[model samples]
Target: MEFKPDWEQAVRRFEAWYAFEETDRPVMIVSAPKAPRQDPPAPGDLLRRWTDAEYLIARHEAAFRSTHYAGESYPHCWPNLGPGIAGAYAGCEPVFDETTMWLKPLDRPLSGIHPVWDEDNHWWQVTLELTHAAAEAGEGRWVTGITDLGGVTDILAGMRHSDRLCIEMLEEPEEILRVRDGLLEIWKRAYSALADITQPVNGGTTGWLGAFSVHRTYPLQCDFCCMIGPEMFERFVLPELRELCRWLDRSVYHLDGPGAVKHLDALLGIRELNAIQWVQGAGQAPTIEWADLLKRILDAGKSVFAYASPQEVRPLLERLGARGVALAVGASTPEEADYLVRMSAEWSRP
Candidate 1:
């Protein structure tokens, strides 16, 4: 069964959510099927596959073909370079496994190491090529998403390694701040380059997160903030985040786990950030359990993007109403996706 999406209506719901206005219903997205698994890569093959333009484009096309887009969901594929690719572009070596990639920490102390963007870097070139190829492949069928560029502190943790960076935050706070300022500029350059390549083909900007915007939009995150206290977060991370928000037309924070909940107040206080995507990590309560937290975000005047089962949808709508909630729901078939979309409309406020 083919998943057909209502493009015009989806855009309307998204624009309403961004403006903190009520829609006829919350934005309801149906999840696509998992791409069929491929055999394990031989030594060196994974890197080769990632860099090969034809291979990357074909893989994306196959996945887009396999699923149905329903309700607020739309088709989008980002080159999967993992979250630390931004750090890799800035002079760190990346280690690749079967499913994802990681950055090798710098061997020297934070004070001695200087990170700069290398245009000729192998990973950087691969990222640029892959993005262009995906854009070409997605010409009429799907949207090409921006790769995971990661946040300022998150990229630094990849280069400096999280544990060492934590210690240095105490020992060399000034040095850390100086490095962060430089990295923010590199991050902006990299994001702008990808956006330039992607915007025309995508028909608008959208990222790994499925929210769509005619203007620029991408998910901003700092998983490392989960490990730090709020004082350190305010001092080191907030300023860079503010600058990033100011640069984008629309932005959403990816709040990863319970550990990062402490910083929500600070995040809500940022006038430029339009929304929050709260991810309650594994082994914890599901999204339904966090209605209070979700309510607080809404109360603070920011929209929310969350995951919920078909069974949980009515309760969430009843509790949170339909003003500013965007929900992603999973279904096994196109018929199921259609059913849920109808149900969502019924549950929504008139």
Candidate 2:
């Protein structure tokens, strides 16, 4: 079945901000806690729901319906298995359950290190199949694609343990490059396949009567390189990141946590990067603590994705000009969402 997208306006608006173009209004979203959903749906369930007119409503609200243990508490239906799905085809096996997925090593500290590319690999096959399922299920919903994978270091760390990866940097430097380059090839290939999948709906591609033209965009991510310092990131992660960025229309770095903040210099310096999704970590002062970081990102001439309390909305607007900030707030109903949207729009403009 042909992939379909019902939120072209939302997509274009997001792409515009992702590309750092000044938009007419900021995308003010109501970021709410997942009010317990009964019989939480999977990708297949979503597809089934999308086919039914009533189900489409549920599919559209899939984000709020999904549950996650940790990390970006967004919808789980996006199917972000890992960047090493391609690498898995080369010998790695991915483990998937109801909640999340991860790649499993073949043997002791990297035994089955084969440079193969088979769609039959556990991770690769599952993702490929899910793409079809989503295309079918997403009949008239939001687009579905894998997360924008970071370069080799990121993939390896994910496939292999971080401690093992640190050892590999010394013990198996050559293998590291082989794995890195191999994963790069695979990352690009997987994304290209997804690109083909979303092309009918303009998923990873750009161009929609906008003032700014994005050479490449969609499949947004930057989870890798954020954990390490700038030096480590430069030597191990940046090269592949550069490669990934060159392929997309507008690439935004998902700067996750204060640990990843060290790479902020490298991220801001990269010309190809369009914006930064500052994922403020949990605990006290999350939305408020990152005020300076937001300013720095803006100073670097990039956009930001932030979530604030409804009460904090006024101060947030006063502090950060809304030219490039996308708000994810929690509103009770469409009326409330509309009110906040209008308020944000008014504050953001002048």
Candidate 3:
């Protein structure tokens, strides 16, 4: 299946969101199925299938064939070797399972383990190759996304193990900070390399979220923040995050769950941070229940990207207004998708 997206309108909606200006409505991206799609690989071949560039490309094509991308939605494939791939690039061994991959934390002391970016790293080479292959396959069809290079603390957790890293924060704070600072340069370098490889093919930059930016943009996150106190967060995590925000042209903080929400004020204060994508994890109140929190983010003058059901659309629009909100809605049918878009436009009108 081929995709001819409304490139102009998509661009306009996104630009308005970034500028905090009013458009026809908040950007609504709907992915409704047109046909039954192939299921993902079963447990045994999951890692193997993900590593195969041809299989990855073909899988994405087949998935897109079964869906209709409407409103601000566009077809994009974010090539990833899981979130811990950044740690793997820094010499940590990645242990892959049926569903996900994680780095094997160092057993020795922090001083004994050295983290350095190896251009020749096996995972790095595979990631680059997969990126190139996806771009080639997506030519004239879809946009390819930047791989998920997680934040400083999150990557460190993979290398040092989350539990030990927590102890390091208390026992050897300065040393931990030093290691994080050192990794900053490597992170920037890796991002630059991938950006260079993907820009020509994507015509711009985007990430797994499917939002487009004329300049480079990706979801920046620190899942480890949940384990640390606010003081430790400021001392260890915030500075690195600030520096990254300043380095990137555009960025969205992936605020994962309630534990991370405690740092919301600090995150919102960063001038260079463009948006916040809230993931209210399982068993938490649905997306609609967080209207007050979402409102605070908006009132702080930052954009929000969230997933919402059709029933929650009008309420969200009423509560947050439409200036800088983007919703990723999964509609059961194309007709429902069209209805939601129309309703959002109506609610947005002055």
Candidate 4:
């Protein structure tokens, strides 16, 4: 590992975390900027900013050069075309804005909507090009991750708007399955294709979540499940998630927000699902607010990961007891990163 000289040690730590065991300390990923960050004026075209391969690669390279990755943290460059890029690959219209990008909804009946994988889709090509360029620049320095092709049902919700998909799931349940079945195929094809490109260069694989593994692993998700009940979730989302978990060597479900907690039990039921990344979402800052929830996931027999602050790490470890707990956090200085790594041994349960 070029950027990570101590990668083998980190791998040992990660393996313990995945198996619900503690190494010398619970896994804590910490990073600090090598120097203070400054901003330059932005270009007017959001589309070019998102699509330009050289620009994207150089930007990641700059960040890699400017950040001190410590503890379990490592340099990872993931193609972030927002979460709905999968819908774009299925030929859905994309609307670019200043902060993010989204797919323009079709909002038509399921019977009329037939989504297929377009091998030559514009955004699809952009994502591939971006991955290749990032890998070239980051080959020995940083790791390149596959783009977020997104979860199948979420792609359907993006393709047909969440409101319309909610209606279709009830009024035309079978048709809902019909369309999602198609999207599921597209999801597999897209993931497999990107994995083929990333694996050889990355020496394994990583995702937007920054969790790295020597074998195939992904942060599986279906944010749309927050809209439906358990019955609907099990019917529409669970089967696809099961297939993904079975297919991949390892997986962690990205359980985001209050709305998503409802599906936790259903997700936990998947035998192959390795862990859960619990996000407290907006206004839920200072992750310690969710100690009970974090403990619940650990009790359910899966390793847990969350974003916390340096201040929250010790208390979180205290409350959760650190057995299967991992926290990804930011520090302000190289000294702070070193401090956290040393203090984590104190934070972990004996």
Candidate 5:
């Protein structure tokens, strides 16, 4: 809260945004480069860049300190080993890349492999090491978020390959559900493990969605849901998602693109879900143009978050109102960041 004079005020905005309640303005996360930008030399090897805890923490701290975290944006680091990391924790080997890690599928059916948390999995260890280092470095200086533990259905797809999982679901529905249920337990255990380290250090929680929570909060998602229809989603995905939402104090569904929007009605019906992060996907349209879809989510009484350019923020807020919307907007200067904060109040509606 020491980032600005009104830091506590910004926290209040986030709390209101989470509850879909009235506030002075919508919560916006805006960050701009420091006046004199600094860039460190790139690490030589991609593997070391990811697994080297010291290097990862240094980079996180550099970015955390150099940028101006405006609006609801603040210093937080999640040990991202890609979104499918839970698959690796369950025994699938991960092929590394600069941007994300790919979880290699099983050569045979996953009927034999029981999903459980491997405390000694290399990537899991990397996650813990990186998180521990970041937590120590950021103890009183910043808020460090939990790792992306991932969704159960997505982990199943990652382990068995999406197409193979589809066939397995049709051929052996009960076994597939059993494995999914096991993965759900691992997911819950992973969260509790990470929370044990993160919560007392900062007295709050956050996840890859870049939102803050006073207690347990997450951006729950199932990217594989896009490949399946509503019936399959209800049978395989919905039960676990519903259970997660019920267990967590705050939860947001990550609804991605037109493909997954088919499940929007079902997602909106979940009384425990607190919000939605609508990722409209690339090469389609600016999120500002999707007012009707966003308003539909809002009308369903769930808070929503979306992306916008700085120029789009005003009209976006004007159309959507200030009640239950949060946006991630980019700024190039401190003045522009300040302007967006003011515009939030100016454009807010009843």
Candidate 6:
């Protein structure tokens, strides 16, 4: 282990609550991994997103500590694999390496409307390896699960050109659904396998939380809603998502950027959801611009899991309160992490 956790009791307490067992520990903070801005950037602006084993470990370690520190906080972190893993099951190709994995389309969706998966697929094997390794590393610190939805909708765009998918929405709606359904079937199997391989923190128990047990928290996700109108999402995308959510536990919907705000209502309507992790999406909003949106979600009676800097805490506590807010901040030393924790506790206590 790269970092030997100093908070073992905290870790056990979190594991208990995460499995939905009652615990006497008090809650203080939330656990989440910071999304690192990739370096040596992807060549050509092809919208490349990548994840490596080391990065995944870092995220898991951070999440374990955050959940441990909070005592009663949710222990959540993703398998953090590459974006194209899901599409590869649908017959696309993903490039893999030590640091990150990426996907480049071999054929357009219209060329082969159907998708296929086998025992030796590159992305599938790589993702499975990374997921297994992450679970081993968790070591009772926190529950580890797979990363993003493998860019589900975006990969569809990459496989079948976005324009083609748009046209297919009308020309071949059934074909689009077939491909989407196939991708989802693979996701369900992956999640089930992951969930089965990893059991409840108490070791395989069936209950309220077990039914929602996820080996990984952020398994399937997409930001494509930012590009399409709400009408398109409601008709083409929403039902597929509803079907997908039914199979897993503790989903945290990723609200990417302001443009995707329109779909928030649709996401909220899904009763199985545990919380919404809102990414204000860079620039000035990381400071204060997101406060309004945070308040809106809290007002809707949903728990909010988001990153907040020390500077943003006062206004955030004033507006959204601390009962259901999760904060992620960068602290260079133990002293700083301690100070921030103390400040957050004071603000959270009524």
CA RMSD of each candidate after superposition: 2.5, 6.3, 1.8, 1.7, 1.5, 6.6
Give the per-residue lDDT of model 6 (tens digit) for 1-350.
22324345544432342343332322234332333423333333222233355555665564445322322233544565555567776667666665565556545445376665555766667666666676676656544544444545667766776776677777887777777777777766655665555454413212111112323444234676677788888877887667666655545566778888888888778776555667777664573567888778766765665666656765666666555465555454445555665666555555
Q: RMSD of model 6, in Å?
A: 6.6
**lDDT score for residue 12 of model 3:** 76
Worst 10 residues of 2 by lDDT: 67-76
Best by lDDT: 5
Write the residue-wise lDDT of candidate 4 on 42-101 in tens digits: 455778777777767767766776788789998888888888688888878888776677
Query: In candidate 1, residue 180 scores what lDDT?
Result: 89
Compute the lDDT of residue 151 as modeled in candidate 5. Answer: 84
Q: Is 3 or 5 the stronger prediction by TM-score? A: 5
The global Cα lDDT (0 to 1) of model 5 is: 0.85
TM per model? 0.94, 0.77, 0.95, 0.95, 0.96, 0.73
Window of ten residues with lowest summed lDDT in model 6: 205-214
* Alpha-carbon lDDT of model 6: 0.56
Q: Per-residue alpha-carbon lDDT of model 5 for 1-350, expressed as tens digits?
A: 33344556666778788899987788989988874645466679988877776776677767766788888888777778788687788888888888888789888765797887778887778778878887877777778888878888998898888998998999999999999998998888888888888888867788988788877898999999989999999999999999999999999999989899999999999999999998889898888878889999999999999988898898898898989999998898878987897778889765
Q: Between which residue pairs do clashes occur in model 4?
A: none
Q: Which numbered prediction scores highest in TM-score against the true structure?
A: 5
The model with the greater lDDT, 1 or 2, is: 1
> How accurate locally is residue 286 in candidate 3, as Cα lDDT from 0 to 100?
92
Report how far residue 296 has shifted in candidate 6, in Å. 1.1
Q: Clash number for every model?
A: 1, 10, 0, 0, 0, 9
Q: Per-residue lDDT for 1-350 in model 2, tens only?
A: 11222244555566667656776666564533335555435446532332333343355455434322111112223444444445455566656554444667545545456455666666566566656665555544444444434445655776777767877776777777777777777767777776567556434443111112223554334455555556667776777777767777676666777778878888788787777777767763767667888888988888887777777766676677677777677655545555666677666666
109: Cα error in model 5, Å:
1.9
lDDT of each: 0.83, 0.58, 0.83, 0.83, 0.85, 0.56
Q: What are the runs in model 3 whose C-alpha is more than 4 Å off?
A: 38-46
Q: What TM-score, to 2 decimals, does candidate 4 have?
A: 0.95
